[model samples]
Target: MQVRHERPMSELSYQVSAPLKLTLEAGQIVTIKHWSLDRIDYPEAVDILPKSGLLSIPFQGVDIQFFVEFETDTQDTYLKFKNLTGRQRETLAIFYRSILSGKMVSTGDMITSLDTPVDLVPMGETDDEKASDTARASPQFLRVIWNVAFYLILSVVVFGLIGQQIWTRISQVSLMHARVVAPLVEHRNTDAAYVDEILVAIGDEVQRGQTLIRLNLPEHDAKLTDIRGRISAAETRLQALENTRQVHLNTGDPTRRVLLQAYNQTVASLNDRNFFSGRDLDDVINAWHDLRDFDDLARLAKGPFYDILRGLDVEIQAQNDALGRLKRELGNHKDAMDAVDIVATTAGTILQIDVFEDQYIARGMLAITIEENRPRMVRAWLSEEMSQTVHIGMQSRIRFSEAGQTRSVMGTISDIQASIDPDISDDFGIIVSVAFNDMNVTQTRHTFRTNAPVTLSASKDWADFGSLIGLER
Candidate 1:
């Protein structure tokens, strides 16, 4: 006896009870390879019998099998299938059987089941039973979707509420360059006076009437003394001449008495303090000429007596005129000496000193420059466009940074230049001034330096959205 063995293409194989033969007709059955879903072989109008007296059938690379079974009792042919894997067996059964029985199956249904192989059940489950299981699984999936939707809605609500409280403001921002400025007062001297001492230095604060420099005028004082000495000598000579005239009057010569009395009356009128009001020295000189025509004195005194009296009268008149001239010169010297000390006219800080100690300063020369320290102001220049909107009394903020520290002060717009300055560049536009408030005045004086750079911001009166909404209510 001889035996033969053959291997099936896949794990699944079939065997019949005895040798059987079947007749296959065209279009009666189709054989589809499950893995490739291709019709590898199909039945034709031919007869198939067990080969070599065996009742086994072999397939190539087939995971599922489909066959048309004829039931003799019912006289009906139906589709059936077998598969190796439990997953997707029922769906594949229905799908393949529907094709064999000529029942229409949508391509979408076949593709949908093929795409999701896990949705198919084992071979024993019916289509109605699979539907119940699918219905049972839907609640868990829906709950997961609801949870994701709830989180998304919560996030949107939270962000929307936060955005309502936040605000955004749009403003015109600009950089302002500024400096500290104050009113300046200059003290000067014009006379040729020497600076004996300087009492104040730069950066020193001084009060009103404070002495800044002391001056010495040696030449002026010496000239005054000389004028006083000359006036004293002239006065002494005039007094001696009056004493001599009194002696001549006591001698009782009638002619001499009349001449002497006329001379005395003229001298008395010339010496009177009020004499200069009506008659100048020249008028007194003319009166002396009339008094000199004394023929009677010449007759009374023979030789030398009339000559000596005439000489004495001329000497007295000359001395009195000299004395008056010297006295007027002395008064001018006194005034010059009194103007030596230079004092401040106002309270301020000393900015500069032009003259040094012991230096001779001419009259009308600048000695020191003092700036009023209080009421400091910041000066800035704005563009022509910016100038139109800026006005007096607008709120202002000043910022200054130095040595790693920043300081700020509040102020108000005090002035705006009516016209642009010709000396400054046109790009600088118009000059604007801001006066520091009373509370910050002292702090500004201590922290800010003159001509130091600063930043200034001027705010406009505009309502925000919140404020506008509040106004509506």
Candidate 2:
């Protein structure tokens, strides 16, 4: 390493390994000078004697001392130098060679200094050892780099595989527990009657207009039968009256025939004449009187028979009116009896059967409950916070767990309740309804006892980081 200095002349020291053969007189002084190639502002000078000497060099306003020692008593002269301040060791080596080569003059003129230059070798480890050490460390450095790259590739592959398994596109949404239910159609009776037969039972599928139960109303049936009998009897009596009247008309009496002829002639004359004046009106009155006289004479000739016939006709009319009313009552009674066979008004599965065979069911009593099995719906209650994110028509996933198995189905939010249910707990959740995409309750209708517990999840575009790691918010 090269050391840089900011001073004009810096102190440098080196140990001399070779001996100098000099005929030195005692107390002779030699001057050593230092020149800085980079700085020309100041040159430094130091005076030294052979024995032990101390020299000061000015370096950036600070005086640095150099200690030099020479041992002449030894077989080889040893020179020791100390307190080097600058890193220009090569310059110091050259200066040391000038001394050995006689470039440095002795204070006495008798010793002439040579003007030749020489090179000084520095002391340290050889170049071969440095090359060997560098060669040894190169493989280790390359191995470290290779290991880092290998681990980086391995981490990429490992995390990529793990991400493929766990980092799915599925959104992490709050799951709301829901229930599966079909539309319910309640069957009820309008009149009190005994359950004659139950055509269907719970869990049985029924179609529209299919009979679900049969009720027996004996009293209503008896009333209907009695009304029919009374109607029949009334009709027979009316026929007899008609027959008697026809016989009376066919039988000829001389007084009755003469009176009837005179009445007919009088009525014909009255109809033919126009009573436009007082004389015409008098003639009409006369004709009317004559007709009334004949009618009275005819009635008198027929005597008690005619009176009986007239009374029979009045009685028959009254009986006919009564018969008509009775017939209407019978028809109404028959309709009431027919109502005993309770039929389903819609197609669905029978969720409940309230009445059993021979059971007495009262008016407006529940018979059966049928639930429409198509287009299955799931009702979910979401928390108030979660409900804010949910909306109608959003896609949802429904999970049904039963018998140690879980099945998932896709659906859409069909409806949302306008208000929160008062009966629900303080969780403060609103009800949401979902409709299955293509599935119906018919396939798994039996699985729903009342309301099958389900899990509802709506799809979201993004999720939080904590949720992905299974952390609760």
User: How well does each candidate superpose onto the true structure, as a TM-score?
Assistant: 0.43, 0.47
Give residue 445's error in model 1 in angstroms: 2.3
Could you give candidate 1's per-residue lDDT for residues 1-473 as a string of tens digits?
11222243453232112111222343322332221111112223234411111111221222222232221211122112222233344434444445344455556655554455444556797889878887744577899999999999999999877774442112322425577776679898857799999998998989998888988888876887788888888888899998897676465446545656666676676756657566556645655564465554455664465566777788888888788778877876676665667889999889899999889888889999998766678887777766656788888888889789997778888888855554334564768888887755466667777777888877655743344356641
Model 1, residue 104: distance off in Å is: 99
Residue 407, model 2: Cα distance from true site in angstroms: 3.0
Top-scoring candidate (TM-score): 2
Give every collision pair in model 2. Answer: none
lDDT (tens digit, per residue) of candidate 2 on 365-423:
98899888565588877776666567888889888887899979888889887466553
> What C-alpha lDDT values do all the predictions have?
0.62, 0.64
Candidate 1 TM-score to native: 0.43
Worst 10 residues of 2 by lDDT: 37-46
Residue 321 of model 2 has an lDDT of 93
